[model samples]
Target: MKKITVKITSILIALAMVFTFVPASVVATEDVTEQTEQQEQVEEVVTEEEVVTEEEVVTEEEVVTEEEVVTEEEVVTEEEATTEEESTETVVFDDINHWAKDQILKMHAKGVVLGDDQGKFNPNNNITRAEFTAMVNRVFGFVAQAELSFTDVQGDEWYAEDLAKAVAAGYIDGYPDGTMLPNNYITRQEAAKIVVEVFGFADMSAVEGNEFADFAYVGEWAQNYVAIAKEKSYVKGYEDGTFKPQSNIRRGETVQMLVNSTGEIITEAGTYTEDFATNVVVRSADVVLEDLTIEGDLYLAPGVGEGEVVLENVVVEGTTFVAANANLAGEFATVVVNAPVAVNIVEQASITNFVVNNKAAGANITAIAAMVFEPKAAVKVNGQDVVAGSKVTVSGGGETVVEPPSSQDPIVEEEHSVYEFSFELPTEIVAEEDVEVAVTFAATEVKDLGYENVRFAFAVATDVEDAEVTFTAVDSEGTEYTFTNEGAWGPAAGFAIPADYTAATDWTLNFSKAGTYTITFQLVTVDGEVLVEGTQEVVVLEEATIVEEHSVYEFSFELPTEIVAEEDVEVAVTFAATEVKDLGYENVRFVFAVATDVEDAEVTFTAVDSEGTEYTFTNEGAWGPAAGFAIPADYTAATDWTLNFSKAGTYTITFQLVTVDGEVLVEGTQEVVVLEEATEEVIEEETTEETTEEV
Candidate 1:
């Protein structure tokens, strides 16, 4: 083509030389200059010569087609604007940081786009037809509506279904020869057309302003779609003020455009109740919502800012995550139920399968009236049954309290038959005393399936060494159980029963030392399934026996339940000498010593007589005898003692009666404690002189 142009220009220059006599050579030079300039215009035309050559033969029609393509190409120039090579080596894509950063990352996180096997996004590489079609299918979850027979798309190919779906969705079509050419790079205009169809934006009017300088290059058939995309901010022109319509769309740009069309990018704080029926992305500011229902997961995204979400009567079918650094606040019923915190069914709310986990601590879940149905056995607060109408305070992670179940509440238990056991014991028993207990166990016949084996387990709790438990009609077969040595110690013990055996057994127990003792029993089957459980209590009393040489006086005392360190504890002893025969016994005194665990605490005691006399005693013993107060000869029942501890620990306050010979007659001790921090009154008393000396 260049040779032909050069020859034509030479002939024109010679003609000009012959026609003009004005220095023929100079005239020829001017004509040649003009002709050369004209030839430069033709040579400037640039087309993808490689594509034409790949098609091979050049017929008359092909030549004309090439000229037209060259003409169109001549108008476009390599972009002169220096594109900033936005760097993001930290992002999934090495070159994904410019206009496509937000959109690319957003879609990547949504699992909508994954880079190549090399983990390179290759943001500048043109996306293949298959790649673009797959992205469109993912965005809309479109399925193939009909079979596709594209010559280039095989049934077993990876992108066959995506191609079929694209065709079914009326977004793409095969060539005249039934070839999809899925591996072929898709153009910007082609992508715009598919995106418009998938997003249902075809009905939208074309945006008025053709802001792109090269907008005229866009095919007439794709102008409307591209215009809509530009208006919606889904597609943007280069900084050079041109939208390269015929340019191949890159993989990164394709995903970015797809995400932009979805409108999932939230930039402000507000409740979204658009009924997405799928996962909702939460970005941006704090949000508050009520009565909103989401059919899918709710994600609290990162990098958005500090977010506080409040949900009221909201329902999420999928998981709801209040990610770390984010705060979720709301009542149980309105919050995410079935999570760490169980839902609250307040007042007339129908009962559902309920569970109270660690999250239930400080959580409210009570009803104004009885439940319509009973909750499941798993309904518990820290592993304990959460009785209806009871408040739960979760402390120390697992500790919890369950108030007695209301009598008006319905019972929730399996309808399985099991043995029932009961025990009866005297409530009051002296220390170092023996006690007897009668137990009754019964199991009704379940029509059939008689039990083959039954067991009874018992445990004794006390600070005593010599203890015994014996079952009267003992039998291994028709077993009558017994324990002669120290009954099983620790928290519990187990016992067993035989098949078809039901009887009452007398359990004799004895304690050699003093302290409170409690006996509990669990009746279970051979398989270790608990049938019935019961507990019986025996308070082993500690009595002070006075020597016959001195007069005897019996008295009881009560002290402060709690005392703080550095605080004065007023302990008023209300006593009367029942037998005041010996004037020596009449003059009673008091003493105190630190308990073994807290013997290091420096405790002091001051006793005051009724007539206004005070006697102070220093803490001087390590769990030993410490001298205390001596009541006046005319001392009455009203005597007060003040105690102060320098450290926190348990202490024993002992009361002693002195005879005339100055011999200690009888003494009794009770336990007391000092807390870590000083109490309100203790702080005040430490700072002031006035003290409230009350019992």
Candidate 2:
């Protein structure tokens, strides 16, 4: 009995040691199994060892139970339980199993929408006007604020700032009663209008016919908006084919509409060819969208950092907001905003209304063509205020300079008298040739006390290189002043005009290349005070049909000084060519033109032959000959042309030889006088009597 009791005590001690060393997590299962087997063995040992006391056994049992309790408690401490719970937590909405569940979840993930404390997305609940505005503001990232005068809105309200942003963005407005019913549920038609305005779809023309059964029930003001939204696929009607315009829009429906409007978020850079049915957000740069259309707005997100996005033959049916620091090229319809970056409107690119938002303060916008701005848009180009709805002309690839509009009641300085200044140019001239320009300066109202020794100055400005201007003026005292200038806006030449003077001067302008040139003239006092100024434009061409002189060849024509009307006269024409080194002339031809006072009269040059082949000439001095008449390199006389005069008037005929390249070789004009038949008869009788007297 003593041995059995000792063995049972040793076994109990071993069991206690095993329980203490085991890990807490495995303690419960292993302890139960080991305790049962030991209990059975202990009972057998206890029966043999009657010396073992019930009190000792009970004490051991209590000790084992306390150890088990401590191990279980350690396995699941307060910190561990909290960590486990957090690991399984997720965003869950119990009521999002509806049609817009995906969209609602998407918006919730973006933190653009939220649920109640119970994690229930009550998508069927009506959305208020203020609530919708907040959603739109978040989507567009609009932070701009506007002054609010709504009677119902308090500055401290939750939606006050968002409503202000929407108003400033020109997408929301208050009622005529000066109250913005922020808490009121927005109807379908009203929501549609807001969506349309937010995307700049207000200018979109409505479809020819409505597809909704309740279309007529839509408010007249919101009808077009609803139609545009539906056409853009931003909104849809119910299953019953009726758009309940007056029905309040639910949260799920609002999310769906917003999602539909912002169709795709393009994050990768590539050339996209697929057309977007709705709005598109470009978050990456170097994206070229070609031959495609975006039915809704296009947003150049801020992620497009200092790169280029080209829109080649791409049409955006809605507004394009350029918020990225990127270069936009190619062609598109209109652009609303370009904040914090320079916008270069390249050549052949046009925009209908380039609205510069307030955020683009001090941003430089360069355009080759004229840009029209919004009426209330406050923007400055080259330190000049851009007037609303006015076209601002910008120089290509240079700083844009805008001229501010003159005030309605401008104060005119009384220091100098107002004068009418005008200049005349040929409007067109040939390059490398000199053309005459006439200028006139006259007072609109002559002052009795005319200022004496008024200085007249002329300046020439051109876009072409190496252009020149030269002229000579003689004053009343016969003092001649000659001046010449080269290049753009060179030094001006000045001369004095007498009092009560209406001065006119002629200047010769020559340009080395084909381009447009401007000649400006000014009348000022001897002290350099400008009285009047004017400018005129002249176009220089590469080739011209009518010119005063020839560089390659010279031509002359001889006709009867006087010929009787209804009679045929012979004209002898000759051409002489000069040697021009390095200029290999080819395909040289002879042509002539005739001008008369008779309207719609046909002048024909016919060779004096039985065939009577008529030569035709174009207004541009191009001719068609019966046979190609190539002019020889030397002085040559080939044709004796006969002309008939139907009317007794002085006629001028121009003869010229031009090359195939439209270069004039020889050009000259001569006049012929035609007498009436009765006058010729009287002259003939007088001539016969004079001859008899001489015999």
**Range of the 10 consecutive residues with the lowest summed lDDT in candidate 2:** 18-27
Q: Please give the TM-score that candidate 2 achieves against the real structure.
A: 0.39
Q: What global local distance difference test value does model 1 have?
A: 0.49
Best by TM-score: 2
The Cα error of candidate 2 at residue 288, in Å, is 9.9
Give per-candidate clash totals: 16, 0
What's the CA RMSD of model 2 in angstroms? Answer: 31.6
Q: Would you list the C-alpha lDDT of every candidate in the order shown?
A: 0.49, 0.58
Query: Which digits, one per residue and each the tens of the lDDT, describe model 2 over residues 1-695?
Result: 01111223323321110000000000000000001121224312323333344334322233221111112211212211232223223346775534354556655544457665566766656666767777766665565576664556757876777767766666765664446777766787888888776666677798868657888898888778888877777776654567778776666667767766766656557888877765787766788887887876788755576776767767777678877654455456768665656565665665666677655655555566555454224455545656433345665554565544446643332333457778777757888787776777776675544554345566768766776656555555666666665221111222444335676666666666777777667655432355677877777788886633322566677776567777777888765556533333446666677788866554556554335655533322445443434543444454677776677777788877676666775688888777766566678987999999999
